[model samples]
Target: MSIAPNQCTVFVQVWVDVNALAQGSTRGCYAVSNRSQQSSGEGSANLHTNVITSSNVCWTVLPIDPQYTGDFSITNVGAESGWEQPPAPVAGMPNVFTGKLTQSTVGGSVNSNIQFSFDGDNQITVTLPVTITPVTQ
Candidate 1:
């Protein structure tokens, strides 16, 4: 699917504890924030988007700690008719993801999760919950 040049982009900053993650401890190893700066709270943030028919939106995942190098995979937890199937990570740009608002009769929302896995000695996966709301316009 081709995305518009001016498509709205949502940025999700991933905070990770490299040491803890490497040690296979996911307790407080992962957190997601919409802001570029780190927050005291640990967990994912709700991301809202306003869209028109065929509107394209992109999600970019940025790991706070550059030391933690791993690919991110996004999964839709529930089906939302207002949005087309979410796109996979852009090839060569593993951190970038895209989704398009559908022309459904009704606007809907969906809960999605992104998993960041480390291919290091200890394979650990951290899932960040995200809420996607498509507002029909």
Candidate 2:
């Protein structure tokens, strides 16, 4: 049996309310990572040459095909964007944004601090655990 390093990871979060309109012990929550970016500023800039490195840059695990309609803040992120924070994520694995990917740690968890404001009595931020399975040829 050969299980080739087959499993790419991605992060997904959804948020929703859970009370007053009882739907069970759970509610729809959006996945959030503290590494989420703030887009109300500059685009990617090369500090070495002081030029804008424009490309599809995502700081954290954001839904590529976003289903919800709202605005998110992608904050001060630069060359060292995409990283989860101090005490890093071991070796070999870079904390940098790897394209359209949000890591779903097998033996750990990633915490994202997302801000939410709604016009309802129930409010909560949920970090959804998304699974990624790599396909083989």
Candidate 3:
């Protein structure tokens, strides 16, 4: 994740195909997002569901960041952990997940990878290339 070195927070948006995963033979889905702590010696991230569809399926989403501390879990509105899988197959629009990154302190260049797993067997991973550089005042 490449971001302004002087910032306090990092924002990330992820789009996923829940319908495709649900309609398939898979039984679950996992969505993930990652970000590094800013130069301020604080790091954290928040996640939320943006797009919506029918809630007929079940899923589990978790974060896998190395520098994560405390609580930073996100799930669908009616989901139990992280986000819920759609009840039925979706069409046209895609499911969206949003996240915020915070760190305990400036940890140099960070590489965060957000992953989405479906049906326990199918999985997809997305990486956030964050580049932090010193900014002039």
Candidate 4:
């Protein structure tokens, strides 16, 4: 029996509550993804996916308060060997961030964190946990 390769694109949406931040609270910020099972912390989510070998992951930040203007960046916390570093924001999609995952021979289970930093008058950074399991083809 031949096992087919599993490949997919995961989209993670990041929501920022400007009013809450203005009021000195970071709890309003949160992130959710189509493949995520649960959410955690301020602007964090737990992603569980079977597309381990090659997957396209993207994150887009949406501010609750339109008046709020700022910039954000993705920082790698502890990604494994198969994980590819996040590249610069896409030209047309300024708010979108993306990365990729390659196949790893020295496998186990892949656990990683993708950290996002929002820069404005006050900088707020959060971590999103991602868990990926390799699929044999």
Q: Against the true structure, whose lDDT is highest?
A: 4
Candidate ranking under TM-score, highest first, comes to 4, 1, 3, 2
Query: TM-score for all predictions?
Result: 0.59, 0.22, 0.23, 0.60
Q: Report lDDT per candidate.
A: 0.50, 0.26, 0.28, 0.57
lDDT of 4 by residue, 18-79 (tens): 67765656566666666544323324455555554566666676788788767666654335
Report the candidate with higher TM-score, 3 versus 4: 4
| For model 1, the run of ten residues with the poorest summed lDDT | 33-42
lDDT of 1 at 103: 57
* Residue-by-residue lDDT tens digits, candidate 1, 1-137: 53432465434445556666677665544444343232234353433333344655565554556766565443322234556755445556555566665655444545444565655665566665654444444
What TM-score does structure 4 among the candidates reach? Answer: 0.60
lDDT of 3 by residue, 35-87 (tens): 22222211222232221121112222333333333222222322112222212
In terms of lDDT, model 4 sits at: 0.57
After superposition, candidate 4 runs with Cα above 4 Å error: 1-8, 22-25, 36-44, 77-80, 84-94, 104-106
